[model samples]
Target chain A: MAATIEDLAQAVFDGDSRKAKKLSQKLLDAGEAPLDIINQGLMGGMSEVGVQFKAGTMFVPDVMAAAEAMSAGVELVKPLIAHEDIQSLGTVYMCTVKADLHDIGKNLVIMMLEGAGFNVINGGVDVAPEKIVEDVKELHPDIIGMSALLTTTMLHMKDTIELLKEEGLRDQVKVIIGGAPVSQDFADEIAADGYSPDAVSAADLAKSLVGAA
Target chain B: MYRTRSLYTTAGFQVQQHLFWQMLTDDQCEAIVSTAEELLERTGVEVLSEAAVKVFEEAGCLVDGSRVRIPSTKIQWALRNAPSRVTLCDRKGNRAMMLENNEAHWGAGYTPTEYYDQEKEEKRPFTLADVEEFGKLAQMLPNIDFATQGGFPTDVDEAMAEVYAFKTLVKTTTKPIVQHVRGLAQAQPIYDMAVAVKGCAKELAFDPFVALHVSIEEPLQLSADALEVITFAAEKRLPVIVSNELVSGFTAPAESAGVMIVALANSFAALVLSQLVSEGTPFITGGFFTNNDTVNELHPVGSPEVSLLGGGFANILRYLRIPSYGFGGATDSKISDAQLGLESALSTLCAGVAGTNVIAGAGVFESGLASNPNLLVLVDEMACETERIMRGVEMDEDRLARGVIEYVQPAGNYLATKHTRYYFRSEQFWPTLMNRKRIDDWAAEGSLTLGQRTMNKTKSLLVAYSPKALKDDVVAELDKIAG
Candidate 1:
């Protein structure tokens, strides 16, 4: 029998990791494409969790467990998918800025980006401007994601962007900034390409900026 | 037993001894202060209301358009009469003071919208039931002295959810409740319920036990609805925590001290307005400041500038002789992992040392975007540890010498001595979940991270906790109000 989207989605939501993985593998083996399993089964399940989360019908641990189950299934099918056919929207570099070693926001953006089909390079906390520039030069990523949890270190982003401009690399990269203190007005003031209030919006913006939406 | 001495000065001021001393020599701090003062004088604070502007002008502050230059003398005068200590009264009659000295009380606060998703985890919106669960959990924790109704519950109507959460909070725990007065229509019902539970008609209004937070986005820009809430709350004699959230480099100034002074001026203006509206209305002055560090230029929480801003605000509050509210236990870390521990510990320690009262920002993750029951347990542990630190080491020669001499001269071990048994428990707050077990014991149980242990503890609480039942009449009234 062909598995329905609801059945696959429910398996992920129920936190049945073994079943979620097995189902995804079986579906792939039976001729269902990997992207279909991801969009219909995994992302669909996460969307329900988000609503429950927003509605208070679910709690954090429940959502966390479900996400883990979904991730397990996704990992199982990832290797079977071809690169060009993977339907990834674009590449983005994300980091928590220097002297401010907080990564929760960056990590969320990463997860959201992955869900939206963007390849993410997570530069861990207290990332120096030089390192970001170096990554930009080497990877030539479409977007640079910078984060800071401290007001003192937030100024570093401005400096980083200025350095990129001085190196004549500003036009090559679209810069997106976020954290507790960031705002759209600030983004404009800092000459950043975009600003997002939260991770979901960040993903949406990433897709839009890359002309993938 | 070791006694924790009060670091607060004789005048009931909890001075930031370290930060203040640092400020004396730090040119950066001095420059920021001067620049901030200039901003205040040149730009002036925008008074949200014409009446508030009139009040300041009449009070001798220089008013030029929307910006009002509040001279340092005026600022100092306004602070002089601000009450240093106020008691927070609970429905059951138990109360805690928003102490004047550096004796801070730590508790969990409202969750931000995006907390759990960043950790690759999911935290759903809070509900009345979840609030009730949180209240029970908070009461069981020795460190959390008070609790607020967690942020917007998605399951129920927003207003109804808030009311139910408050009602459940009051019923479940004896800890003083920090409340918010909804729009004018809902205020009376909230007051009535508070009165029914607390035993005073004006108890919710005048009692220090029920402090209300009034949000001011910018200097002088109080929303009309917020003003109405404050006016109503003040008439009842309740203390108000007049606070502003400044997004430094965006809302105020890029310089840390510059941002602080601007926030301080606005906070002072709000408190003065509150006092003017009704005399003898106790107030706490504080603000939230964050560093704007992002490549996209979106503000994120848990920046060092934010911590410093918090610390600076705590000091100013102490200097102004008002109880201070500062953010603590919040980190930019998405998970209840190693990063959470470090960020929470540092931020809390800073607040504690600065002697903040009404310390908030606990049980939140992902830069205040989400709330976690398990994280609350860990945050409580961090608060307890900070309290222990603020208590400081007993300085008397007898206790210090007793152990050393006894071990050197006497043949007996201090571990078995009378002093050790009496003092050890008081000196250390043994964490309920943080593992301190031997390798063999830890191995036997399968070594668990602090997060796992807290999760287990939370599960046990949820299973065992029977929330305090509200009286039938009260329940009926609450349901009707919620409906």
Candidate 2:
């Protein structure tokens, strides 16, 4: 007669977004603790998704679907918890660097980070160094992430970091970079705080950077 | 992978039916043909050559100034008249290659103006000797089945370049040659030269050793040079390849299907003209589908779009029962490196699996401006690998080898079995350029990279190999023609 939190977990695992959101609202309104509904219901299903993904039983689109469903349920549960009580991995400001219009990889990284409980501000594509610096100053993110698919535009990642230094904001923010042409050596040469080869690893590196892993 | 059952017969050869792939279904292919026919009827192609425009006008096509808008019935008639299979012969005039369905054949590549000179370690203009060397390389490479103009020799006059290249290629290689000449001036002499080698015009025409390639300018402009070449090819009963590079973001529509519509219309127009000139003339059709990259603003032959466009074109051409031409083993990298290997491998593999006939570009690279014999050797190895992949596994009872498996059950090895001995060569891909040795053993043998090994092999072949020389009379005849 009553829909339990186990049904909510099953909804998230099955990627049923509407059912998961409805069940989440139903449970929270029924006086279930907000964090309990998250850790045991939403994250409970997402953790199984992560395990199956690493076990090769699931694929990228599958993980993305599960992530979307979890996010849908989380959207209903969040804001009910106190501001400081909710644990976020970190805040990341992300954009594709100047003169490059590619954003497929950047969008995937954002989805992955958001799925992993990180607060991400999407800066979109073709962002110049000056504009990126202004966004960083205003957003006050814990980490800044940059993406570029072209070799010419990847150099702008360095320029953005240099401009951040010139603006005296480099010391306060950790910078990470990813793209087809951006390598780990390139990250080190440009003094990037981190380099993730793919969207899945970007989440792990973000969690570790914020000391949340 | 070998089968004995025959599905169709043409040109005295029985073609086996294999499970070849197509990028489009039957309905999609028919839709493309319909759209292309409509394009021809509505917005016609510009026939800059007055002679070609007159032919189109006399055939009841709408002629507005230089533009010729053709009817769908004329195109359908041309499709029926054009031979589905165009058989090519070797230097001796024995049928060798049957270009039907997805019978893929590898050849030496797109004409290059410059070449990598290993001795000087620099890229420079090609000499006449370089053209001869390319012919020799094509003849020597086991997997390379035919020859195309590999380089434009700068030492020769621009007017005489095609003639001289043909003379060298005819003398050095026994394989079928494809000529993309400037006009009838070069094409005529080359045909006469082939007649001289083959002994008579009638015999040469019947079992043609060469095919004429005509380039239709992008956005549908057929120049006098292209028309003259195609006309000559049709009258002589020689096969002709009507092709163009429909580069997306430049000469063609951005979407693949939109580009396909243009490609089909352009080549179909040429086919119509050829059929009108002489019914039952053999025609091969395709578009070198590629993209003009945003970074370089050049149609990079190695890009993935080349494979995509080539595969789709091949599928549609096969649906129409026409042979197709495509590209493979070309690269965008300026030098031989990991990028070169990756691009060449993927493109060649795609061409192989898609069942494209006459896949060219063995050595040409740097967006098709340079040729490297050493790189060609590396590509030849990749071609071998691709061929092995094309020879898919046999699933019949003998190949199932249940008996051998049961005998060698539970962590047993089949290395010394008779089944392994009998099937290893056909099943495994043997590479010539790839080094597969232990690190210490490799270092002991001088730590040769693939490039170094390719150079050694190329130089050794050039030094030790030469095609059997032409008869003294034929040589004098060729000299007179070249003069």
Candidate 3:
């Protein structure tokens, strides 16, 4: 019997973590591969939710519930997926800059990044520039994401990027910045790789930059 | 009843009078009035509502599509009907007349910008409990005269959330509330809640005792949702505090004068629309103007020019015979540190002296990203002092020389005089935290920064405070909705 995508998609859409795990497991047992389940089930369901979210047809809670469901499905199939397949996508390191402890934007990026199947290292908030550079050096992350909600702290993003350039590591990794005060022009002026207004778009930019999409 | 006192020091009064003198000469003021007339005649503000446009057209305004050219006569007519003094209502059926003509009133405000948390991957829906708690905190604090049900409660259903929050706030505190509603569906509910709290019926609620916070993105292009809210609130005869935020480069020309003109045009447009909706709805016209720094392209409120613009706008609002709203305690700095304090104090003092009716932006941080309850406690102290400064000292001939010299000659010290005993408390604001202990006592307690002290104060308030319990029936209804 051909397993319809709707059953697997419904499990993710319903935010039923238990059913999502079971459905993905059943799909794999029925001979569908793990990558197929991720591409057609988890990613597909999340994409639909993102559209609804942007259109205001659904709100933040709806998106959160849907993300939870997709995360559940991803958890079930993660062990079955090969390391080589997972490693195909590049890594992204994200953090809110120092002296700014707020983290709603950073968390949204993490959710979107994980849903998009990228390896994400969350450095959390008020992250010092030295720590970010150290993480960059050790992790050799392909992309570094920085966020600053305050206009005063946003200057720290510029300082971190300057430090990276001085260390001869600017060319090694792509840097993307976003927050309330950050704009596309500001990102361009700061000479960063990109800027996204919101989290889902940030995921799209991250994937495109790394040639994962 | 508390008697209002002048809150001005000589230094503060001189500083504002000088700025006002520099910004507007008689000729310059006349020029601005002429420019406003030109704008009305030539460009005319767009009236999105068909009925509002027709009202203007019938009053001899030129209509080109949605834009209605408000002739000088129409502007004069609208201003003539606008009340110079309005009684804003409190929760307990008491009222305060915010004199709108020449005199300014001072009141403390709470900033409402922190509800969006893009970083935490979580948006907390601020509940009715949060609103009630905030109101209780405001009530206990000596700083605030008015309370805005704490900014953006996350738990609220956005469609009609503010109505519930305002209802909760009115029940919890006696302070006059700054009622704000954002969407169309919320208008009727907010009106109903206000009437119920004010103990009035749908027919007689036109008491001009309740204050409604009305905002517009542009003068002519009001938010469709906000307009509905204003209309519903105005029908109850509430005084509309029509305010606008003019981003120098983006919203208006980069020139300060241009920005002021545009803000004035926008404010007047709102005033006209409000009047058209309900003829005698009292109005407060004002704008929040801060230039975008060309170097940073970020709007910082601390610059001297920004202060000048705010002062000028306050003067303009007074000239138009309406009360005004001013930004108080706002700073570009992210952290709740020295930068926040200096910027907040300077900007707030400028607006307070310029005779603003309601001053906001207190206790906010991260350029309005975060609202720390501790910062609020500190800012309230500043507001208390600022209000003392706004009430200018009486200097009439009899009070100035007679008792002062006679008492001083006899006693050699005014300490024993009745005037000193009567006016000491009125002369200065007693701070809650600033002078808590002597130097040696403070040293024994370990020198704590204001931030630390504020944190302690916030925690104490949060722990000790109990909000007024919602009605059992309303609580059950809300619980069912929450589920």
Q: List the DockQ of the predictions in order.
A: 0.01, 0.01, 0.00
Q: Give the candidate order by descending TM-score.
A: 2, 1, 3
- For residues B113-195, could you state the per-residue lDDT of candidate 2 as single tens digits? 99877546689897788888888888888888888768788899888798999998988988888776778888999999999
Q: Candidate 3, B106: how far from true, in Å?
A: 5.6
TM-score of chain B of 2: 0.94
lDDT by residue (B1-483, candidate 1, tens digit) is 332343343465344332221232345544544555565556666665566667678778798775677665654555566677787865566556556766687777664533243234676666666677668877777788787765545566665555666777877877777765445555566666777665567555555455666566664456555566566666777666666777877787788766787776667556665666666677776866787775747555566676788887777666556788887777777676788888878887777777788877777677666776677777788877777777665545445555455454544334423354345556677767778765545777878777778778877877776666768777777666555
Worst 10 residues of 2 chain B by lDDT: B1-10
**Candidate 2 Cα errors over 4 Å, as ranges:** A1-213, B1-19, B118-120
Candidate 3 wrong stretches, greater than 4 Å? A1-213, B1-26, B97-130, B202-209, B294-297, B301-306, B396-425, B459-483
Report the poorest 10 consecutive residues by lDDT, candidate 3 chain A.
A56-65
Relative to the true structure, candidate 1 has a C-alpha RMSD (angstroms) of 23.4
Which residue pairs in candidate 2 have backbone atoms (N, alpha carbon, C) closer than 3 angstroms, thus clashing? none
Score candidate 2 by DockQ: 0.01
Model 2: how far residue A110 lies from native, Å: 62
Question: Comparing 2 and 3 by TM-score, which wins?
Answer: 2
Q: What is the C-alpha RMSD of each candidate to the true structure, in Å?
A: 23.4, 21.0, 26.1
TM-score of chain B of 3: 0.82
